[model samples]
Target: MPFVICLLFSWFLLPIDSAPAVASDPLLICWNNQVKPLQNRFVQLSYQEQRNELEHSAEPWQQTPYQASGTIWVNATNFRQIDTLRNTTRNRTSFTKTQADTQTLLVKHGDDKLTSVSRAMLDEHPLTAARYSPIRLIEYAYQHHLRPDSASSTNQATCYRTTINQTVISLFIRRADGLLDRATLLAPDDMLGDVLTTLTYQDYAAVGPSQQPTRVIVDKVNGKVRDQVRLTQSIVTDQAPTLLDTPADYRLDMTPTPVATARSEKYSDHVYFVTLPHTDDRVMLVEFTDFVLVAEAPLNSENGELIIQQAHQLIPDKPIRYFVFGHHHPHYLGGVRPFVHKGATILCSPGNDDYVTYLVQAPHRLKPDSLAMAPKPLKLEAVGARKTITDGQFSMDIYHIGSQSAHTSDYLIYYFPSEQLLFQDDLVWIPKTGKPTRISTRQTGLYRAIQQLGIPVRTVIQSWPVADMGVKTEIPFAELAASVDSK
Candidate 1:
């Protein structure tokens, strides 16, 4: 009776082992390939990636990838790569080099310190996961359950779902050949929830004693795809790759610090101009009877905040009533978010509603911007031909250029008829040195638009200044016209 009671007590006190056991054999079986099994071996893969033009703003674009080709040297847990990408819009090209050096999956981009691969890249690529190693997956399964994926129902493929580091990954294996067919990973990001990334392995060919996927497709964020492998050169050498090594001449360019001085220059008695350093983008402040109006909230949120802070310090009495946008390019429009958070009304051009809507809707939880922390209802007013705001003493006219450039489609120019001051963006890039001014096709169009508007202007306030060194404030209208008329 004593022995029976003790056995029952022990049984009640011990933890229940009710969870089903996951077999490592099945996972290893699924990870194998006949041509080339991906394991603890080093691989050098050269692939080409072509980008799709999709404007998603929450994720900042580092490099414009019209077309790029790079060679990757990777082992089980580490890799070094160099990607040469081209910016088709700017007609310029640049190179970005990255490498993983440590055991904790820390990667370094150029001269920067090592950062975790997961934190550095938006997409958790399969190549970075060591696809051939089932040991990691087995260990993960011990902590989390690995079960059959019911959604995958192909005649030749069997799918299994498992969670690794909070990311849900589904692996599809070919039943006949036991090769990795596809792996779909759903990673929940703070900014974008449940971001889907897929890797498809196809066209298996024998490289050495093992088989390798000659063609692989990596489906990235926002429907962008990196597919096709044209080059099939592989070597199983024991020598370390020099391409993986960081060059001695590599240097990271530091960004210019934004000066927080509330210094304001008088464009006129009622109008003030404040130029933010680094980019030399200026914000115009129009003082009215009841409230103040601001023009062109450009660059980023920090820039917008600095401008608004300066505006508040300068005026201190009137509330900022309207925030006007000059053009709808991502470069100039980033500052709109901060103004929106401040309860200012946004006045933009037609077709700009969609872009603004996207701006407010997209999640910024990754970094948690100023606007994201202090949320506000987005107030936007779309104008077509003209929109005017006045308090009898002072008035401002916003005019749509009705001209499209390779830069932007719908551009708006702000005009102060009373001051005879025309404020425009990217129409004419003023030469830093006043040596000789030659007008391009863009400048000619801008001059014609000003003529058509019948607005007499004495001075032109180009959004971008002349130079960082010797910055020129307002340009004489004659100098701008002479450049075109003289030619």
Candidate 2:
């Protein structure tokens, strides 16, 4: 009688195809079933790829997208063996690996021996090689707080959703098949409200008792496909992988260092030019009767604070009332928040008000900044075609260099009519001593704008200067035109 009862109980407990699904922790289910099974296989993969060329400016005139072919080798325990990519354009090649038995990241270019990242900085920095690994991907998801938002079953697959807050990462996993289908990362930016990066994994193939995606697509938030990788071959090897070893001659420095001081000079009675060392980027400060006006908040908060500190020392009684952004580029706009924290009104091109507003108000809890701590409402002003500011004795003009310019559509350049001085941003990047290697279309446009405006320009102060170039402090307009003509 006991044996009969035991058999009947076991029969009822066995899972059925049509039965209601038992609740399962998605991350754990994927890790245990999918990632663990691939732990001991040594894998090799080759793929072709195309990616957008990374640029510093908001918009670049002639930058082109690039395509490449690469190979990746990995050990099953989430260790990168080797990854090499060869660009088709110039036949340039680069590869990355990690030290054996160490978490240190290493990289090498064509004909160059492997150079490892500083071990001191290794722990704090995230390794790119590990992020996409089958095991590491699961580990990363587990480390973050994961909530099972939903699950659904269809076509021999079951997908589960999970999210990470800071970068707004959304993960979709097919738990039944033990595969990650897609991940979306949304990063709020100063120019774009939300920049999306989407990764899709498809065409799964079996290799040595493990399944791996044979093709992956990466897309930008702008609906442009940024990169694609398609697998050519996969191999499971038995011998110990040798790709992680590095040559002794290669070197890498990982120590974080202090930023250098900016060089400052008084261009006019109240107009000052400050050029940051190493970066060769300039910030212009104008002392009005009651307050100060800063042009071009380039780089980050550290750079912004340095500029502000100098402004305070020079004009102790006044606050920075306005911070005029040169354009909408991320590199130049990073310092706007620091000025906002100091109760300054952010001034930018007319259309950029919404983005700047969103920027100042975005939550920064994870990495709280000065703006986040103070929590003040942001003040903003917009500049149209031409705006002028005067304080009885001194007057300044801000002109909108229309979209016809090469670098950006909505750009602003500062002109000090009294001083006959002009502050130019991306339009006129000059070296310290010599002419530019080539005169860009933007530079020519700037010269035309000056002529069209009929403003007397004695000297042009460029925001970006090449470091170590032996040149004068300012470029004379006549000499600039001559150089362009020669080019």
| Number of the predicted model whose TM-score against the real structure is largest | 2
Model 1: lDDT of residue 7: 30
Give me the overall lDDT of model 2. Answer: 0.64
Model 2 regions lying over 4 Å from their true place = 1-40, 57-65, 77-101, 111-116, 119-127, 130-132, 139-174, 181-203, 217-228, 239-245, 249-252, 260-263, 403-405, 429-437, 466-473
User: Which digits, one per residue and each the tens of the lDDT, describe model 1 over residues 1-487?
Assistant: 0012223223233333324434443444543433124355556667665653434221233224476677766543456567776667667776766665433233444566544344333234333433322223333433344555444536777666654444556667677776667766655343332345666777776654455566666665533434333435654443346544444644333344456443578767788888765656777899988788888766567677888898888888788888887776544676777788888898878877876776665555323557778789999998788988889878888898755322445678888888788887667755657744445676778888888888999988777653553534467888778877877
Best by lDDT: 2
- Model 1, position 315, has a per-residue lDDT of 87
Off by over 4 Å in 1: 1-41, 53-65, 77-221, 224-263, 404-406, 434-438, 469-473
On residues 19-90, what C-alpha lDDT tens digit does candidate 2 reach at each position?
Answer: 222347555666655455656665677667776654543442223466656566665333544455555556
Residue 124 alpha-carbon offset, candidate 2, angstroms: 7.9
lDDT of each: 0.61, 0.64
Worst 10 residues of 2 by lDDT: 1-10
